[model samples]
Every structure is written in structure tokens, then in C-alpha cells.
Target: MQSNQANDQWFQSAAARDIHLDQLKRVERFNGRAAMLGIVIGIITEGLTGAGIAHQIGLGALVDGYAACRTQFLPFCF
Candidate 1:
């Protein structure tokens, strides 16, 4: 009887682990799809607006800041 109980516990733990791994796989797939969708949208927006993705998102200031920082030899500039 104790041996049967041990086997049952081991089976349950294995099943639970399988379920968790399946869930992780599903989440990873969803994240990958979402990232691809974001990239496609960015590309479409850039094409429509005739602006690069960085410019559309207002990263120009950030780029300029980095250039300024490089010239000034600053440790940190944003």
C-alpha cells in the first residue's frame, strides 16, 4: 500500500510538471507572435509616414543626447 501511494505521488508530481512546461511553451509562443506583430506594425507605420521607426517614436532627442554626450565625454547624459 505504501508503495502504491509513493507511485501515485510521483505520477502526480510528474503530471504537474508537464502541465507547467506546457504553459510556459504556450506563453513563449504568444510572446513571439506579439513581437512579430509589433515589428510588422512598426514597418507599416514607417512606410506610411515616410519616417523611420525611431523617428516615429520620438527617439531623435535621445540620439542627439548621445551624440552630445560623446562630444562632451560625459559619463551619463539623457
Candidate 2:
């Protein structure tokens, strides 16, 4: 009887672990698909706007400011 109980417990533990792993795999696949979709959307946006992702999101000024400061040797450009 004790051996049977032990086998059942072990089987249940293994089944639980397998289920957990499957869930993790599904989540990872979803994340990968989402990332790919985001990249494609970003590419399309850039094509339409003629600007990179950073500029589209309003970071162009900061980047341009830094470049200007570097070229002009400004003491404080931040």
C-alpha cells in the first residue's frame, strides 16, 4: 500500500511539472510572436514617416542635441 501511494505521488508531481513547463513554453512563444509583430509595425511606421523609431517617439531632439554638443565641444549638453 505504501509503495502504491508513493508511485501515485510521484506520478502526480511529474504531471504537474510537465504542465508547468508547457505553460512556460506557450508564454515564451507568445512573447516571441509579439516581439516580431512589434518589429514589423515599427518598420512600417518608419517607412511611412521617413524617421526611425527613436525620432518617431520624440527622442530626436535629445539625440540631435547630443550630436551638436559633441561637435561644438559644449561643456554641458545634457
TM-score list, all predictions: 0.73, 0.72
> Which candidate leads in TM-score?
1
lDDT of 2 by residue, 1-78 (tens): 999999999999999999999999999999999999988998999999889877888999888888889998667877
lDDT of each: 0.90, 0.92
For residues 18-68, could you state the per-residue lDDT of candidate 1 as single tens digits?
Answer: 999999999999999999998999999989988877777899777767888
Error of 2 at 6 (Å): 1.6
Index of the highest-lDDT prediction: 2
Q: lDDT score, residue 28, model 1?
A: 100
Q: Spell out the clash pairs found in candidate 2.
A: none
- Regions of candidate 1 where Cα sits further than 4 Å from its true position: 67-78
